[model samples]
Target chain A: MAQLTMVQALNKAIADEMERDSSVFCLGEDISDKDGGFGGAFAVTRGLYEKFGEERVLNTPISEILISGAAIGAAMVGSRPIADLQYGDFIFCMMDQLCNQAAKMCYMSGGQVKVPMVLRAPVGATQRGAQHAQSLEGFFTRVPGLKVICPATPYDAVGLLKTAIRDDNPVIVFEHKKLYGGKRVEAGAIAPVGEVPDKEYTIDFGKAEIKREGTDITIVANLLMMYRAMEAASHLEKEGISCEVIDPRTLVPFDFDTVIKSVKKTGRLMIVHEDTYSNGWGAEISAYVAEHAIYYLDAPIVRVTTYDTPIPFSPVLEDYVIPSTERIIESVRQLMDS
Target chain B: MEAKMLLEMYEQMDLIRTYEETLYYLFLEGIMPGSIHQSHGQEACAVGMLYGLRKTDYMASTHRPAGHDIAKGVSVKDMMCEMFGKEDGCCKGRGGAMHTGDITVGAIPANAIVGGNIPISTGIGLSLKMQKRDDVVVCFFGDGASNEGAFHEGLNGAAIWKLPVIFVCENNLYGASTSIKNTLNIEDIALRADSYGMPGEVVDGNDVLAVYAAAQRAITRARKGEGPTLLELKTYRIAGHSRSDGCAYRDDVEEAEWFARDPIELLKNKILKEKIADEQILADIHEKNEQIVNEAVDYAIEAKEPSVDDVLLNVYWEGD
Candidate 1:
């Protein structure tokens, strides 16, 4: 086992997959060393260009449509491509390619072709204004054919990404900027360093991991929110309020069963996410729990999400807008009181 | 081209023409479901560009894709079944007229979104280059597609990487109801290739041999790893943009002029005048294709509707 950050784990995962499968290749803007070695927006692909050579690690122009469409096309013809976007917000530029083409190719083609590709995007509120900081899981989770994955820790990052690379369908890996612990540090970044196993291992989608075991309440979160939720659980433990924290590794093939089971034990549920309030992924979980495990609930389900507005540049306003551990604790206290 | 090759090209063009004419009537009779964007006048463009391509070479098509799909070697029966929304269709009834294709024959399912297939073709080309394969990809779109951002991005990527992709623009002078003259400021869509540093050519879309010769040059260049070519085939669609269009937007004089230069008739006259084949041989080819199309129609009419239990299938590939 070796201690690694999320970015290092992701780089290792890509390198390992490329080493194993010749069909696998990387393509994005500034991904190669030829483009001053930025190694993608977060330096996750830093040494890949040198290790794999220019043919495998391609540097594309600032054309999101071409990157996405070409990835879909390459995937259609037996190439497993890992396409990267600088920020998750840029995915809007290639909506037709992702939502229309890659998502629907298999069904539209009547199972004639499969787009075995991965799109990696960094998402989080890092004080970069509205266009840069957006939690895109909500938007992509609503898309049917595409699988959405958000890995919070280094271990899950390697395992989930490896599995996504092997899957026969298109998957979007939404890595939070704050969680990608590397040189480019942000204000609220957690910089979690975890030990990744030396042996090859893959994490299946639709499987939830319980970060902390408790009984008073179930806290469901992912990516940056997962770390924040863990912090809240530790804080709540001092006040005699035991909290169970769950990280849903994959959003589309959501591990609802695990969440429901957790809710059953705690008899209370509080969902947290950085995405906006209205129609967030938390809303879906709330509804699902209300439908299946309502009788087990001691209190009404609560959602702690960012306010319904674009992410602002100001640090104070950004913290106020997005969910905080204090908000989670207060929400948990209210649910406990009720 | 040999006499056999010329006759085969004529036969394929006629098959597309006859299939489209048959579908038009079936649609008129209310027997066919959904709408269609027929390629009635641009038969030579599809046949000429795709005639000699190996089954392994990829072809990406746009909304008006029946001619491209058929010419790319998707069986008439499969296409006919797709038009009828039957289970035996190439796309298993999921794709209607605009989205029919057979991937086994290197025809990716036709994209219904205008200019959607342009960038996708580049990806296929990239895959071929990565695999060290000499196979090429031919992407077909209308004149209006040249103005789309996908066209610019796709063509530029192909040029920079020298990917073997042939971007074919069938400039039928209109996009749905709008004329290219009103939409584009330039006279020749091929000139747009200069922006990407690729060779661009214009062909007489109504002349089968002329289109064939241009395609030969472009395909040869691609096979030699010389990069992408943008070929603008000046042609006109004999039918309306879709099922409901009465074509009131078209000018009668221009329509009559293009209609007289029918690609099939041009090929027929060329075949007879050049002594490539007698009139009787050309007539027999048409009759044989008509019979084949008729058999396909009968097969499609008898094909079963897709099972509801399987409706949820293929949404995600479960296994082999």
Candidate 2:
């Protein structure tokens, strides 16, 4: 085992997958090493171009539609491609390619083709204003054929991404910019470095990882919010309120079993996410828990989410808009009081 | 081209015509389930461009894809079953008229979105290049697709990488109801290729041999590791854009002029004039192709409906 950051782990995962499978390649803007280029927007792919050469690590023009469509097409014809987008907000530009082409190719072709591809996008409110900063997991989770995964730590990043690369379906990996603990540091970034195994290991989808074990209440979160939830759990422990924290590694093939089990044990549930409240992924989890484990609940389910507004540039307003550890504690206290 | 190749092209064109004409009547009688964007007058474009392509070479098609699908070697029975929405359909009844294809024959499922297949075809070309294979991809779209952002981005990517993709534009003068005259400011759609630094050509879409010749040059260039080519086939659709669309938006004089240049008739005349085959041989080929379509229709009508239990299947590929 070796201690590594999330971005370094992701780079190693791609390099290892490409090394194992010749058909695997990387394509996106500024991913190549020609002319001393940086390895993508977050530097997760920094050394791949030099290691794999230009054919395997291609640098595309600023064309999201072409990048996505090409990935789908190449995947359909026996190539496993890992496509990258600088920001998750740019997915809107290639919605037709992702939603119509990649997502539906297998079903539309009557099980005749498989689009084994992965799309990586950095999503978080990093004070880049509305166009650049948005947590887009909610949008893609609603899409039927696409699988959505958000990895918070270095270990999950490598395992989930490697599994996504090998899976015979189109997967969207939403990596939070604040959680990408590499050289490029952000204003409010939390660098979560963890030990990743040197040997090959893959994490199956639909399995939730419990960050902390407790009994009073269960907190479900992912990406940046996962770390925040852990912090909330630790803070709540001081006040005699034990909290259980759960990070759902994959959103689409969600491990509802783990959440249900945690909720059963705690008899209370509170969801936390950086995405906006209205129709966010938290809503789905709330509804599912209500439908399946309502009788186990001692209090009504609560959600701590970003306000229903675009991410602002001001640090104070941004922090206020997104969920905070204080908000989780307060929500837990309210649920405990009720 | 050899006489055998010329005859094969005519046979495929005849088959597409018969298949489409048969579907037209069936749809009119309310027998078929879904709507069709028929390719009635654009037979030569599909047959000519796809005649000699190997089964490993990919072809991406747009909404009006029957001719292109059939010409690219999707079986008559599979397409007919697809039209009937049966379990034996090309897409197992999930994808209807606009989305019929067989990937085993190198036809990616036809995209119904206007210019959706352009960038996808470029990706297939990239895969072929990366695999060190000499196979090429032919992408088919209408003049309406030329206005899409996908067209510009797809063409530019293919040019920069020198991917072996042939972007074929069948300028049928309409994007559904609106005429291309109102949509495009330029006279030639092929001229847009200049922006991407690729060779572009215009051909008589009604002439099968002309389209074949242009396709040969483009395909050969692509096979030699030269960049993509944009071939604009100036044609017109004799049928409406879809079911129940009357030609009120089209001028009678323009329609008459294109109708007279019927691709099948042009091929028939050429075959007889050059003595490639006698009139009796041409008649036999048409008869045989029509009979094949008739048998396919009968087979589709008797094919089984897809099981509801399998409706949730194929949504995701579980394993090998």
- DockQ per model, Cα: 0.86, 0.84
Chain A TM-score, structure 1 = 0.99
Interface RMSD list for the candidates: 0.7, 0.8
| Model 1 spans with C-alpha error above 4 angstroms | none
TM-score of 2: 0.99
lDDT of 2 by residue, A1-338 (tens): 99999999899899999999999999999887678887888998998987899999999999999999999989988899999999999999999999998999889888989899999999999988988899989998988789999999999999999999999999999999998887789988998889999999999999999999999999999999999889988988999999999999999899999999999999999999988899999999999999999999999999999999999989899989989888988888999999
Question: Chain B TM-score of model 1, please?
Answer: 0.98
Whole-model Cα lDDT of every candidate shown, in order: 0.93, 0.93
Top model by DockQ, which number?
Answer: 1
lDDT of 2 by residue, B190-307 (tens): 9999999999999999899999999999999999999899999999999999988997999899999999999999998988999999989988998998899999999999999999
Could you give candidate 1's per-residue lDDT for residues A21-47 as a string of tens digits? Answer: 999999999898765778888999999
RMSD of 1: 1.0
The pairs that clash in candidate 1 are none
